[model samples]
Target: MGPHIKGKIKKTLSSLAGQSAQSLFPDLFQNESAKAESSTVIVPPPPDMNWLAHADFGEQQKRADSAPPALLALGGKPQQELIAQKLARMGYVVTTASSTAQALERLSANKYRLVFCGADAAFEEVLRFVNRLTTDQRRHIYFVLVGADLHTFYDLEALALSANLVINTRDLPSLELILIKGLRDYEQLFRPLLDILGSTP
Candidate 1:
């Protein structure tokens, strides 16, 4: 509290410095300071991981580009799933859209070789979307309308509806065969046009 006591304390602390009592005042002792510095755990910087993510993305993109062409199956869940399964088994990537808006969005975002509109779908809206597509855009897609009132493979009805094929819902059990036959005819009918346009699916 007084100058004399303070001087005594400073002298005692100075004496304890660099001595075995250095442990009592590490900041005042050079050995303790060096020891404290040496004992500090130095953490290494993290490794660069951005390249790994970029590499994975690139691989996935490559696989998607090289994979089979995609098709859209628009309908109720049951019909959409059944059609998707059949198309997938036939070596095509099938995307399902439960509503007209969803189907339109999918069509606008991606190129689909085929579009199967089910009886439950909003036919007028889907047809309007297809009708609005430019010739160049429309030519690449094979549109099919599936409904109970439609006759399977009815060229006249298909023409009226601007569809490549029309299938009766009752004939859905044989969809795979019908699709094979219809797609064969479609390719034969459009190969020349597609070739001229410089785009073939």
Candidate 2:
């Protein structure tokens, strides 16, 4: 090709390359003023989960402090009266039920911290009810099984029965002392766990 023609062709090619570059990447050709006028992205901060947890814990603590702990005594009239008197002495608001159906109805109506079921009085059904409770609900209740044959304060028997304590019917006279001892042991075992979970009983 002639020198003049070659020079013209090269100039035309350079002009086309610059136009193609501008079309492919328009941002690259933007003026400094235009770039400065673009909007800035603003991100919202994350939610404060710790604050929510603390608020929930505070509300539970207030409710616990305001109410007397509730106790459900299920069995014969004589035994129920004895349990009621003994637990009331310890500041519990005791409710009595003569049968398993009555006991289940009471349980559904209110949240009881303590539950004493006579082993000879529909104990199996009550035990099943306790067993089927949610983990959160089960941990909050202190279940006691009272029977003529149960060994009082026997850890193995209590564990087998899924009860917090097992009390002999003969020891109903000492129900106060036995319940105090059982509560102390229960607190020692569960306080740390409840603290870790940030739950109140």
Task: Judging by lDDT against the true structure, name the best candidate.
Answer: 2
State every prediction's TM-score relative to the real structure. 0.62, 0.64
Q: What is the lDDT of residue 119 in candidate 1?
A: 49
Estimate, for each residue in 47-164, the C-alpha lDDT of model 1 and write its tens digit. Answer: 3323322332323222222335555545564566776777776667777776778887888888887788864446578788889999888887788888878877768778878999
lDDT of 2 at 77: 51
Error of 1 at 196 (Å): 3.1
Error of 2 at 4 (Å): 93
**Please, what is the whole-model Cα lDDT of each candidate in the order they appear?**
0.71, 0.74
lDDT of 2 by residue, 60-124 (tens): 22222233565555556567787777777666777777678888888878888888887764657
Clashes (backbone N, CA, C under 3 Å), per candidate, total 0, 0
